[model samples]
Target: MIFPCILSGGIGSRLWPLSRKDRPKQFLPLFGGESLFQKTAKRVNHSGFSAPIVIGSNDHRFLIGEQLSELGITANSILLEPMGRNTAPPALMAALIAEESDPDALVLLLPSDHLIRKEEVFLEAVRGAEQAARDGAIVTFGIKPSEPNTGYGYIKVVPGEEPVRRVDTFVEKPDLARAESFLKDGGYFWNAGIFLYSAKTMIEAFKTHQPALYEGLLAVMETRHSDLDFTRLDADLFGKLENISIDYAVMEKAENVACAPVAPEWDDLGSWSAIWTVLDKDEDGNSSLGDSRFLGSRNCLAYADQGLVSVIGLEDVMVIATSDSVLVAHKDKAQDVKHVVDQLKSEGRDEVDRHPRAYKPWGY
Candidate 1:
């Protein structure tokens, strides 16, 4: 059976007003009615997948359970991290847990913050991954590069079968020149951070590629506490882990790595600018998330909640207002607006990391 493994602990700092530390992007309903986590769950559900196992922060256990209950969806488990140790450990931990019950179960590892508009294409890619995964391959969904995105890493695929191929290399975020050249060339796809593999294969890859993480995960599994839909891992041991990603820990070093193409209109929704791309534009080519009044404005995104955002003749600008902050940046520059929050924190600003209303398992 296809069991989904949702990694919900990614704290996106770029989408500041909407995505705060206490109420991060995954939990925020910035997309529409459903939060990104809920939307990811729905994707797995609509694909006729089995009940999922979610891995998130202990602080978000209540919020997660409440959300699942609200949607009338039940998860197999909800594993908690004491602190954010990045993707490698949590992914390995989830794989171990899944192996305990079903050694051969294919676990589709998904990050909670991505937006895939073409669900059918995504499912087809998953189906393709299923074939490669059964052949002892750790498969990743690689989105065809539409433009030169410096924000995302690149995955070079070695030619193989019709649907899936061997991953030749995993490249870091390139410079402007290299990114442009990558787009000019073919065979390179954006690393989507989505994976599919058997519970058994992932655990073994961890043991070989990341022995330290493998041992750490073993300790967590040994003493993990399961209550309702939550599993609180040993906080101290989990905290000691070296902050690393699955790419560095295994995928880069592993031989049986495969890349499956996804033809979906997908976005990680990592920043406000990315969000603007998916939203409906106004008559002036502007996208407004919340209530706002605009006059003589053209090609601007206004997400106003705190006060009246009146834009006059602004071209390609992004304006976001929250209870404690207002961010107005050029549309292209919104990607770098996160540095503003970083500077705020350096001056002892708490609003950078938190919002007025926080979400919990008991409800928002």
Candidate 2:
């Protein structure tokens, strides 16, 4: 069975005033009705796929369980970390646990929050990467670049066939000029952060590339135990491990790295600007949600949760409103919203960490 290891450990500070620390963007229902997490859970519930193994925050245990329950889906396990230690440890833990059950089990690691419009194409890519993964290749899915997006990291892949190819190198998010250069260069693709590899294969890669981290995580796993519906990692031991992303920990340094170039229409939904782009707009390029209206507004996005929001003669603006706070930003300056969140955090503002309506085990 192919295991889906869903990573759900982000605060999503970028899309703040709407997305908060207590309830991140993944849990919010931005689209039709289903939340992004629920949508992701439904996407992978296909033939040859097993129940997902969710790696999420300890505080979000109830939210995770409740959301999965709403869809009549159950996870294989809910691994709770004492603190956020990035992707490497939980990824290693999932592989270790899967290795115990079946060393050859394919682990498909994906983010909990992402928009994938084309399910069939994505499933095909997953199936396509299975063979390469079984052959000891740590395969990551790459998106065909449509623009010189400076927000996402780029992957350099060697020219090859339809499904998979040798990954040349991974590049950080570049500046405007470098991003444009990459867009001109036909070999670059956006890193989707989706990985597929066999349990034994990934474990070996970790051993070879990040030996110390691998060993330390193994030691922490030995002390792991159950907490009701969650598998709790030993707090003291886990805190001592290095906080690093899986990309820097293993994939970049590993020799058996591969890239599955896919055109599945995926987006990380990372910022307000990204959200505006995906949202349906009117003739004047205006998009509004809740009790919101626009008059003579062009290229403006407005959201109102509690009250009526109206925009008049506004251009290239983002207006988001909740019961407690409202945000008005220029479309080009939407990326700077996180700076506001950072300042709020430094000032010890409650708005930085939570919304007016708090989600709980019982109700919001």
Question: Which is the leading candidate under TM-score?
Answer: 2
Where does model 2 exceed 4 Å of error? 360-364
Query: Clash pairs of candidate 1?
Result: 62-361, 63-360, 63-361
Q: lDDT tens string, model 1, 272-359?
A: 8888888998888888887876678887888876567777777888888987778888877877867877888899888876687765
What candidate 1 gets wrong by more than 4 Å, as runs, is 46-48, 358-364
Q: How high is the CA lDDT of each candidate model? A: 0.83, 0.88
**Per-residue C-alpha lDDT of model 2 across residues 1-364, encoded as one tens digit per residue:** 7899888888888888988878888988778867889888999988798898899998778889998998898898999888999888877888987777776799999898899999899999999889998888999999998889999999999977758999899999999899999989889999998999899988888888888998999999888788888898788989999999899999888888999999888888988888888888899988887888999889998999888999999999999998999999998887899999999999999997777897643555
TM-scores for candidates 1 onward, in order:
0.94, 0.97
